[model samples]
Target chain A: MTQPVLEVENLATHFFTRDGVVKAVDGVSFKVGAGEVLGIVGESGSGKSVTGFSIMGLIDPPGRVVSGSIRLAGEEIVARDDEAMRKVRGKHLAMIFQDPMMTLNPVLRIDTQMIEAVLAHDKVSEQAARERCIEALSMVGIPSPAERLVAYPHQFSGGMRQRVAIATALLHRPKLIIADEPTTALDVTIQSQILAEVQKLCAETGTAMVWITHDLSVVAGLADRIAVMYAGRIVEEGNVSQVLDVPRHPYTRGLIGSVPSANPLGARLKQIPGSTPSLGRLPKGCSFEPRCASASEACRAAKPDATDYPDGSRVACFNPYSLARAS
Target chain B: MLAFIIRRFAQALFVVVAMVVIVFFGTNVVGDPVWMMVPGDATQEQVEEVRRAFGFDQPVYVQFFRFLADIAQGDFGRSYVHGGSAIRLILDRMPATLELAVVALIFAVIIGLPLGLFAGLKPDHPASRAIMAGSILGFSLPTFWVGLMLIMFFAVMLGWLPATGRGPVTTFLGIETSLHTLKGWQHIALPALNLALLKISLVIRLARSGTREASLQDYVKFARAKGLSPRRIVGVHILKNIMIPIVTVLGLEFGSLVAFSVVTETIFAWPGMGKLLLESIQRLDRPLVVAYVMVVVLLFVTINLIVDILYSALDPRVRLAGKSE
Candidate 1:
């Protein structure tokens, strides 16, 4: 098998504050092969976004990847300094932020930003960079790519702005693209359109993707594989269909069940009994123990390591759904 | 863009007209200019001759009309005590003030911008903290007190530079300024440094805050994410973005320095508009005083207009916003 575009192992990003350390991303492990999309789904504060930022080495002061090995295409990136990390960024790996504005410079023209991205890592002439930027723009379905290139970000609509951002990431045809919910702010139609365009782009360019989002439905449609995160840890990992159709972890089951379409009309969406556990003050044993219905005394006695199931999905639960079904 | 400029110009005209009214009536209301013209031995008839010659004998409203009419012809009347046409005197002295202000502003920008940007980039760095502490002192010390201390240290103690006065002037383009000569440069150096002390700190603070804000902007992060070197990020993105505010503050401060250099100029006796302002106000040289204020008003309007143009040029968002407006 070809090597994956990215391989992350035991990644733990922590935020140190006067109050206490917030374990934003604790022991997240995943891999994305070229041309594959791995959707990381969880509610807000589940560390999905932080995971992407940690991979990009964009985490600011007080928030750091304290422990982990992030390998992009076989090289370890976790311990790289800012300068070394910068060289890897946008060339080997690129990121699309949640707010397109967060990726677009407000004052600069689209072409200036796009071309700069190209020239930053490549020894290309201005003309070649410009050509690449225009091509990237049209590839993402922006009409009048030439005119759009001359325009500032504010001139583009929200959907178009996101397309521009996606286009910029596509400029270098990076091996890995980590999108932090780029379409979450858009309306349903625009979101789907951007998703389809991005997915199509990734497929065409054979670029691997890590799409972080809180929407399971989005993952069901777009992701090849899905990793469900809860309280800074990946609670479930498997093929998107297998995980969505029959989640082994109770947290994954709760997430899938809470989707509005799963519930009967006019009924309150099914909710996991309690809110997410705060990372700093998690339950003694399993992070999800207080919220799981079938949890037992053993579940409260120790944290569960990821258990590999026969079907190839992994769940970190002391009393997983397979056992319950066997009984 | 043209419409914006025209609109700004109209607003400026309104302000200048209002300022004309204030300069005429505001000064008149304080006391009569006629009082300064009177001789102690003059009889009532002699006093009336003095009043008529100076046009103070007319009704207040008529005097205001005549004031407006004289301004229309660009004839600022003769100075009461200075014994010269007010406009010519101001024009003659203008280069000296410009020279002093230009030197000070140069000093301010050279000393302030990099330090400000550096401190802003690393707010917690030891050198940054030291710069901030020095800026506190810069902003705290009174300009005159600072000026005196500068003279004491550089002139009295070291005897390296001259103590006072605009020395050994050179003529250029019909303007007399000491800026061309080494002695002249040395003479203006201490006063210019003194004048720049507060403004330098002001620029440093402005640059620092501007740097902080610009560094936090999304594009800067995007730049970092693009793998651009730190040099490119700070040089191209943060610096260009911060130039708008820094230019604005510099323009306004430069204008104010031109008109309001009373303390710094007086302390160093540099012979600028500020010293002229103090002298004209005391002697009731109404024409000179009004002309000085008008020049100041003109400088302010021109600087603000320049700042707006620069703002639009630096920020495409502003230009696009102007178009939408």
Candidate 2:
């Protein structure tokens, strides 16, 4: 098999606060091949976003990668220093944030922002860099690319702003892009348009992507594979269809069940029984056991290791739905 | 833009008029200028004659209108003490005060901005703590006392700089200044530094808070994510955002510094408008005092206008806001 564009192994990011150490991302492992999109699904504070930040090396003070291995395009990134990471960032990898309004500097012109981004990695003339920026803007479907370059970020609508951010992420055509709910703040129609644009860009450029979001429907439409994160750990990981159609983990089943569309019209939405436990005081056993309908005595004794299937599906629940069905 | 300027000017005019009325009545209530003008043993008729001569015998409202009329005609009357045109005395002292204030403000910004940026960027560092501590010291210590200590240390002990008075003066750009020569700089340095103490602390606190807030903005994070050098992120992204607030506060501050630098001027014995105002108030020199205050009010109005214009230049949003109006 060809080398995957991104390979993360047992990545754990912890925040050392005065209260306690909060394991934001603990033991998350996934891979995205060229042109493939991996959707990390989790609720807020479930470590999904931290996993993305960990790979980008953007974690600030008190929050750090306590243990992790992140490989980008066959290069080990965990051991790289800030200076080395900077060269890798925006050149070998890039990121798109949730709020486009905030991602771009308000005071700076589009051309200034984009041109400086290009110059940061490549030593190109201002005119040449400007041309590349113009091309990028057009690629994202923004009209009058040349004229738009001189406008500030506020001049654009929210959707257009996100498109600008997408264009910037694609400027270097990095091997990977970590998009953390990039469309979550946009209107539904604009969300679909940006998703389609991103999908096309990835396919055409063969850039790997890790799209972190809590929306199951978004993943259903965009991701090739899906990983369900619970309490900072991925309890299930598999091909999008295999997992969505027959979720092995009880938490995954609960997630799919809770989706309003997954239920018949007029029927009540299914809900997972309890809230996510705090990472600092999580149980020794399965993190999802507290909320799992199929939880049992053994599930409370020890944390279950992932059980892998020949079809590449993996579930970390001891008594998964598949096993119960067979019995 | 024209409408905005006209509106601002109208507001300024109204404020100046209101200030004139207030100062006119306020000074009358303080003490009669006739007493200050007459001798201690002057007879009642002599005093009465002096009062009639200066129109002090008239009612307060009548005197206020007369004062207003004199101002409209560009005649501010003579200083009872100096016995000259009050406007001339204020204008003559203005250059000295303006020179001192400008130099002090420059010193404050130059020293404060970098220290504040450093403290803000490395908030937990020992050096940052020390910088903050120094700023606090600047804030707490009285300017007069600090000026004396500076004189004692740099002048008396070290004998490196003069203790008091404006040094050898040179005229440049048709304004008298001590800034044109090396010796002049030495003379201005201690006084300016003394005046700048409070302002320095103010700017440091402003810049530090601004930097801390701007550093957390998503654009700054995005700049870092773009792999831009640290220098560009802080110098361009962070600095540009912080400058909006700093420029605004400093602009208003520059006006007050010019109008109310009495303590600093007294400490160094600089012949500035603030010192002149202080003396005029003591002698109950009504015309000069009123003229000096009116000049100060005008100075503040002009400065506010300039600050508004500069605000538009620094922030594009401000320009748009003006346009929409």
**Residue B325: error of model 1 in Å?**
3.9
| lDDT top scorer | 2
Q: Write the per-residue lDDT of candidate 1 for residues A45-101, one digit (tens) a residue.
A: 999989998999999988999998999989999999878998999898888878775
lDDT of 2 by residue, A1-327 (tens): 999999999999999999899988988888899999999999999999989889999999899999879998788998789999999889988999999999999888899999999999999999999999999999999999999999988789999999999899999999999999999999999999998999999999989899999999999999999999999999999999988988888888888989998888998888989899998998989888888778899999998888889889888888988745733
Per-prediction DockQ:
0.66, 0.78
Clashing pairs in 1: none
- Given candidate 1, what's the lDDT at residue B177? 78
Q: Which candidate is the best by TM-score?
A: 2
Q: Candidate 1: what lDDT?
A: 0.87
> Compared with the true structure, what per-residue lDDT tens digits does model 1 show for residues B1-325?
7887788889988988888888788788778777677777779898888888887878989988988899889888888987799988888888889899999999999999999999999998999999999999999989888989999999999999998999888788977878777999899999999889888999899999989988887678777877888998888778887888888889888987786578888888878888888888877788988888778888888888888888888888888878776
Considering summed lDDT, which 10 consecutive residues are worst modelled in model 2 chain B?
B316-325
DockQ class, candidate 2: medium
